[model samples]
Target: MSLLPPNKKKVAKETPRNFVIFGETMNGKTYFTEEFPNPINLNTDGNAEMIETPSINISHQRDSKGTITKSVSDVLSDVIDELQGTKHGFETIVLDTIDDIITLFEQEICEGEGVKSIGDIGWGKGHAMLEMMVRVLIMRLKELSMKKKVNILYISRSIDIEENDVSKQVPSLKKKWMNIVNGNSDYTILCRKIGKQYIRKVESKRKNYTRDKIDDEQIASLLDTVIGAYEKSKKTDVKDAKKIVEQQEKQEELEQKAKRKEREEEAAGESTKDNPDPKQDKQPEQAPKEVTKEPEQSKKQPTARRRPPRQARS
Candidate 1:
């Protein structure tokens, strides 16, 4: 009665969490991400070298001809490819200082369009393209997280924005892009340095900023506390989990059936094109035959005269 095949039935996996950590420089934003399990940092702002974790430097590449070859966007794509195609023992992938990555995306857009700045592209299309690029990156990472059971952490520098004459600290990103980033992440934490002590803020008292208060402690354990809280929140009974798994299996079966039907339709179309139905093809009709009557009276008279001559001779 199971919807999934015997081999396809699997235990519920631990959901990987996406985190956005932002704070001022030297406030331990990068250092905090290192506390995650087996993290591989994608160095965007050259800050990864300062940490002891394994890191890949993402930047513009130059070819032998002394011309700029690959952009940072291309490098990031390669990194994603590596994660997808290769097997490296990494449980978490960190984007150190997402601000740099955003800037790189802008540069890439400008260079591709032959414009000096993103605004130079008329009709506000450049910003849209940049947002698209960033979203694509985040989506790809999310895919990796699901497929590989890896966590994602985005490190960003904090900036002070004065709105309504009130200063607020937030991630150093454009208002629109910041929303996208925060929306996709499971947790948005602010790291603050308070007199020789670094503390993480999980909740905000004011409406100017958004935060997911996972832990109540002002100084909780780094990665463990976050993961524990997330897991605890999602913890379900065994029967409930099984039901959820069954639902997922049924959905997968439905998707597979749809794909199979699509493939069959495509194959049928191709077959028809290669060898068409004979009935469907218009065959030329032959003209109707004309019927002619024979001269029957002439044959009857010749037979009667022969019979009379034979009788007289007898």
Candidate 2:
């Protein structure tokens, strides 16, 4: 680490994406979703016949009064529950015409507020609630895609609307909800019928995840362009990788410091060995030896005296 570094290292990781595919009445929107592996359709529009792939149809439950009605939340909750089951064997989750789900939510809101339309809720509360519901839905779908590791394809019909004095075909959802959906999705695919042939176009492509299992060559080509653009984008991933790199650098620095200290100690020892002190190198002096003497022996006069005394006694 330094005050002025060359550049911040950039890293990228795969992030699973959720897609929104929109088009006209019969421009291959549902068919496009079918290209995904093991797709389970949530037929909100009750138009499963149009989709060639089989789907999981959720029935409207009756209340205590025996009235056949369904709450949007209840239906979505059931789908989430099914997704939680590991034995379900669904690889992808498809929602045909998310516009229908929005309408269902609107109907539920109206029923709760005792109104004929969402506008009747007054003070734009209905719209606020609608946006909230849409946000929740988008968040849950993101969980399904990212946490559950399943691909999500939301199909919706396009509508011709004037935006900033220009008429453009967009997904048939309110502006707020549409913006949220587009922002959350990794790709917004636009399906259009040009002449007798249908064409798929990428309206937006900003995601870290790349979908590779596409059967249609044309659609796959378009997706390749999107993935290439994402690859070229200026993005950085601030994940645990950065932390791991920092830790490795720190460990290397500590090791280098230890090696330098050891070298310094060895050099000091070698200098002491090569340059000796004269005084300490000299041999110690020997102590002086003690002179020892033995006393002279006395003459044997006692023996002469003893012989004279014996002669006198005799």
Candidate 3:
């Protein structure tokens, strides 16, 4: 591949955002998202009173035939048509509290199976169902974002994820189990409460190999933001991304300095051997040899000119 100049490499365009704004229950996420537009809301939890917006209610997800139904895939397809095909002229599409949506799905599936809860299922089928739901939701979101020129907003409840203890990596609670959710979106904001205010922070620990990595400062800080519209810019999500990169650059510089010092020392030692030092404080024998040669050369040169003229003519 051809190389790009540094300035050219730095230039990038922002993707149409499929943003996830998730945090503690009633953390003003809905309040914040409403500022963008009166969104086409797939109101999963039926909690639109919290925000005043023009929203079409798909509280009971059903076909045009109005069948009493709870198929996420079917309802999502319906949701897709209304957002894109409908003459409503909606700009922003919102899916509020997806965690609750999935739970509704779980209940529906459980009821269909003549079971009471996930505990009713044997051989982990319920867990399997949850995984499938995650996949279906992710795929649907991607399709909607690309085909329709619409920005997506997904709001979810907060929960913790296990860290990779071996690698000292603090696995992102948002990314680990719900990577499908996090990866599909262009931006993700992890909201946390600090007294009366809400802080929105971005998550950067997205890679599978990031196990054992932790962001200690971020953990203590109130705000984080991850703009994942571009894969290359993931590092920018880091709170100290520039500084982290700089630190690595600094470490490399130190190593280069040490290497240069070693080379200089090697060159000096070789010079000493080729042109030996006669400074005799350490080696008296070497000094005496130098002294004898100096006098001999001086004595021979002055007398030798007259003697040579007298003796060597024949």
Q: RMSDs, each prediction? A: 18.5, 27.6, 24.2
Residues 12-35, candidate 2: write the lDDT tens digits: 444435788888987877767777
Task: Give candidate 3's TM-score.
Answer: 0.52
lDDT of 3: 0.61
Cα distance off (Å), candidate 3, residue 293: 99
RMSD of 2: 27.6
Show model 1 residue runs off by greater than 4 Å. Answer: 1-16, 64-66, 162-166, 203-314
After superposition, candidate 2 runs with Cα above 4 Å error: 1-11, 49-51, 58-69, 161-167, 207-314
Q: Which has the better lDDT: candidate 1, or candidate 3?
A: 1
Report the lDDT of model 2 for residue 267.
Answer: 92
lDDT: the better of candidates 1 and 2: 1
Estimated TM-score per prediction?
Answer: 0.60, 0.60, 0.52
How do the residues 1-314 of candidate 1 rate in per-residue lDDT, one tens digit apiece?
Answer: 88867876665422336778888998878768877778998988676677799998887887897455888888998889998998788888999868888898898888779889999999999989998899999999988877876778888888896544578788887768778777777667788888998877653221221124422222224544432333333469999999988977986787799899999999999988887885667678889999898766654444444544455564
Which residue pairs does candidate 3 place in steric collision? Answer: 167-212, 168-212, 169-212, 169-213, 201-224, 201-225, 202-224, 202-225, 202-226
